[model samples]
Target chain A: MEFQSCFDIIGPIMVGPSSSHTAGVVSIGKFIYELLGDYPQETNIVFYDSFAETYQGHGTDKALLGGLLGMNTDDSQIKYALEKAKECGMQYQFEFENICEYMDHPNTTIVTAKRDDHVVTVGGVSLGGGLSKIFMIDDEMVSIRLSAGDDFSILAKPYQRKEKVLVKAI
Target chain B: MMEIQSMKELIEACEREKKSISEMMLMVEAKKSGRDEDTIIRMMEERLIKMKEAVDSGIKDASTAPSGISGGDAVKMSEYVRQGKSLSGDYISNAMSFSLATSENNARMGVIVATPTAGAAGILPGVLFSLHKNDGTPYKELVKGLFTASMLGLVIANRSFISGAAGGCQAEVGSATAMAAGTIVELKGGTPQQVVNATAIAMKSLLGLVCDPVGGLVEVPCIKRNVIGTSIAFSAADMSLAGVESRIPCDEVIEAMYKVGKDMPRTLRETALGGLAMTETGKEVKERLFCRKS
Candidate 1:
């Protein structure tokens, strides 16, 4: 089942306008933050389909940025994430698309982030009711469910890139 | 325990165990997660508190949302209900005001529990708190009601969908209303079969509703729809409790919802290209918002 827990249906208390658009997107961004071990200094985000169309009203942009800055789903500071990102000197740009070549879901995003000299690309989809899935990491397709109470840092460990591979790629 | 994947299986489990739907859900959740019942109960209690906080805050706040399309209506509804002039009586009117409060809170980006989803977040809280207000149902009982709601929602989510972008408003608000109907029945001591029938009836009522949020904001039709869903939940619950039966089973209703959503045009499935989203006023709202952003 896509939705496994009672919390998947009733919990994930979050700043709202939407659960799938805002709260689920936050989990995906936080997964990327955990993968990088820190907030990336530079990033490019691509929103697909419904996310692309309604990101503004739903605050999907702020939700993703807040999570990338290590904020949780319920963080009130999400409302001011754009200003916070600017103050932190985090360079970011957004692109929109009608369809994602990599994922079939409407609420999908691909984030490419760089911290120091380490760079990573992540593909994620918000699967409604505050559930999310990390579908791709560094061009490799992987399946990781980012549920509400999951320890993202612990989950990201197995997917962490080796220092040797990073050095060679750089 | 075999996993309860369908309404039939769920009813059978409840009968075989001789437990209420909420009790069955709690047991299944405990077994599946390997967590102690106390811990699970505590977690659900926390969510209940958050939902209450959202309703409490939204009821008094008269400020508008960022889009300026919604807000203050919750305050108006609360005030109207206070005057005791409502035609729908205490249960439904109170539920309507509470639903408005929660959805208004959602539109303002306030913290709220997504009872299935944020778009339909208002319906459960609306009905639960109304029960608390009118019938003196304790907070502890309301927490059990949440489990009942989640159990029904889980089946709908698995068998069909629960996100507007994935299916339509029928999946989002429709599922939440169905869950609310079943929750009400369970809270009111209805049988497991009656609870599922209430769920089926509620789902069938909202089967073909579209997700066409004006300006792509969760205001306008969304908040109002959530308010109306509470009444439907109550109606369905009352019908089931009075020994009424749904013509179609709960599982089949869910299947039909899924099929209809799949056949729906992408434009009506939250793309804002059709339905009320394409109205002149709706187009004006979109232009106004985007123009300000640019």
Candidate 2:
């Protein structure tokens, strides 16, 4: 089951207008933050389908930025994320699309971000009730479930490619 | 201790374990996450505190959301309820105000718990706090009520859907309303069977409801629908308490909701392309908002 815990249904305790559009998107952006181990200096976001249509009303932009800045879903600082991004010297842009080629869901976003010399592209779908899944990492199709309760660092470990380690194959 | 797939199985699990739904949920959480009961309850209690904060702030703040479409209604409702002019008793009127408060707070991007989904967040808090106001139920019991709510919501979400984008408003608000109904029954000392019946009744009432937000905002009809959902939840709880059994089983009702949601058109499912979103005022609001933004 995609939803395992009772809290998944009852409590993300998020700043909201939507669980799918806002809270779930926050998790996806936060996933990137955790995976990258730091906030990106520059980022590009593509909001797809319903996310593109009603992103403003739902505060989807603010939620994503808040997460990218390492804010949790419940952080009210989401409302001022755009200003905070500027203060932190984090450059960002948003592109709207009717569909995300990586996923067929209505609530989808693909983000390309740069942190120093390392850059990664991540695609995600907000699956509602503050639940989300990472579908693509650097052009490779991958499935990683991200709920509010999960250890994001662990869930994101498989896709985190830092300095290449000498492999001793067993 | 196995995962539950249906209400029948859930009840059987509860019966076999000789525990209340809340107790069963706690056990399940402990087993699934490997966390102790105290830690789990503390986490839930923290969420409860956040819910209280949202309701307390929302009822007092008369300011509008940045979108300028939703705000101040919760304050107005609260004042009206205080004046004792409402036809519905203080219980329901209080719930309406609370529901409005949380939903308006949601529009403002304030922190609140998503009982099933944020779009439908207000219903559970509205009903729960109202129960507290009218009956003086302790906060601990209400926290347990949230567990009961999650138990019901988990089944419906797993069986059907809970996001408007995926299943229209019926899945979002409808699932929340059903969860609230069952929760109320369980908190009031109703049987597990009764809780299931209440859930079925509440879900059946709003089957096939569309997600049609004006300007693609969670304002307009969405807020009022949440307010109405509290009444439906209370009514469903009362019916179940009074032995009003749903002719259709809870699991089947959830299946029907799934089918209805699957059959819903893309335009009606948060696409802002049909239903109230396509009405004259809805279209005008969209245009006005777009023009302002551009």
Candidate 3:
């Protein structure tokens, strides 16, 4: 089951107006951060369906940005995540869509993040109760469920791709 | 090694192991997470503390949220309750005030535990805290009540959905109320079957409820619905404890909720394009907030 712990339903201890829009999105961003091994230098976040529709009221944007900045779901900084991102010089942009062909869920986002010369694209859906699942990673359709309080970094390691490096004889 | 897909399975597991629903959940969690029981209990205790903190801060702080649509209702409710003139008795009225407090805190994006989901966060805390206040239930027992609530929520979530975007208010508040009902029953020494019955009865009461938030925020109807959910939870739990059985089973009720949500119009979901979001007043609120921001 995607939800394995009692805490999965009862806790996540997050700053939130909505768990699916806020806390779940944070876990998705956190998974991207884990896959990249750090916060991205520049990121393009595409919000689909419900996420695009009510992001402002629910603070979905702030939550996602907070996660991309390497903050956990419960971090109070999520309220000021935009300013924090600007301070950190973490370049980010948002794109909205009526639907995501990559996924059927309304609360979905495809985040393309770059750290140094390495880049990874992850598509995730917030499945409510602060549970999220990554449905796409770099064009590969993969299902990785992220429960709050679990170690997403370790959970995302297998999906991490080694960037190809070229060395010329000096 | 029992696989729990439905309330029936959960009840069967409880009977087979001679354990309470919370005990069953603790065992399953211990096995699934490979963590010691003490560690898991400590984690739940931490969540309980956060929930208490939110209620404590909210009942006294009447400041408006960023949207200015919701705030101070919790404080108002607490004042009304303090005057000793409530019709729903101290337990239900106190729960309502606490639910309002917790939900108001959630609307402000203050720290709180999502009892299944943040929009429905207030109900569990409202009920649990009221139990503690009125009946002198200890913190340790309250933690076990959380485990009981989670076991029921896990089944509902796995069977259906808990997000308004996926389902509707029925799924969010409804699932939380169901969890709360079961929790109340478990805490009151009800049987596993009674807990499931209470859950079913509570969920059935809100089967087709929609999630039409005004201005797309969790304030407004969201907070009030959470407050009402606690009363429903208490009523459902009382019925279950008194030997009332749901005509429809808990699993079937959850399945029906899932199917109804699938058939729900997108406007009734979290999308701001329809339902209360499109109301004249709702549009005005959105316009005011938008203008202020821009």
Q: Name the best candidate (by lDDT).
A: 1
**Which tens-of-lDDT digit does each residue in B101-144 have in candidate 1?**
99999999999999899999999999999999999999999999
Q: Please list the residue runs of candidate 3 whose C-alpha ends up more than 4 Å from where it truly belongs after superposition.
A: A164-170
- Fraction of the reference Cα-Cα interface contacts (below 8 Å) that each candidate reproduces: 0.88, 0.87, 0.88
lDDT-superior candidate, 2 or 3: 3
Q: Mind giving the per-residue lDDT tens digits that candidate 2 earns over B1-294?
A: 579989999999988888889998999999998999999999999988988899999999999987788899998899988998999888789999999999999988888899889899999999999999999988999999999999998898888899999999999999999999999999999989998999999999999999989888988789999999999999999999999999999999999999999999889889788999899989998898888877
Which whole-number lDDT from 0 to 100 does residue B279 have in model 2?
96
In order of appearance, the predictions have TM-scores of 0.98, 0.96, 0.97
| Native-to-model Cα distance after best TM-score fit, residue B256 in candidate 3, in Å | 0.9
Q: Determine which window of 10 residues in candidate 2 chain B has minimal summed lDDT.
A: B212-221
Q: What is the lDDT of residue A169 in candidate 2?
A: 21
Candidate 2, which segments miss by more than 4 Å at Cα? A162-170
Question: What DockQ values do the models have?
Answer: 0.89, 0.80, 0.84
TM-score of chain B of each: 0.99, 0.99, 0.99
What count of clashes does model 2 give? Answer: 0
Comparing 1 and 3 by TM-score, which wins? Answer: 1
* Least accurate 10 contiguous residues by lDDT in model 2 chain A: A161-170
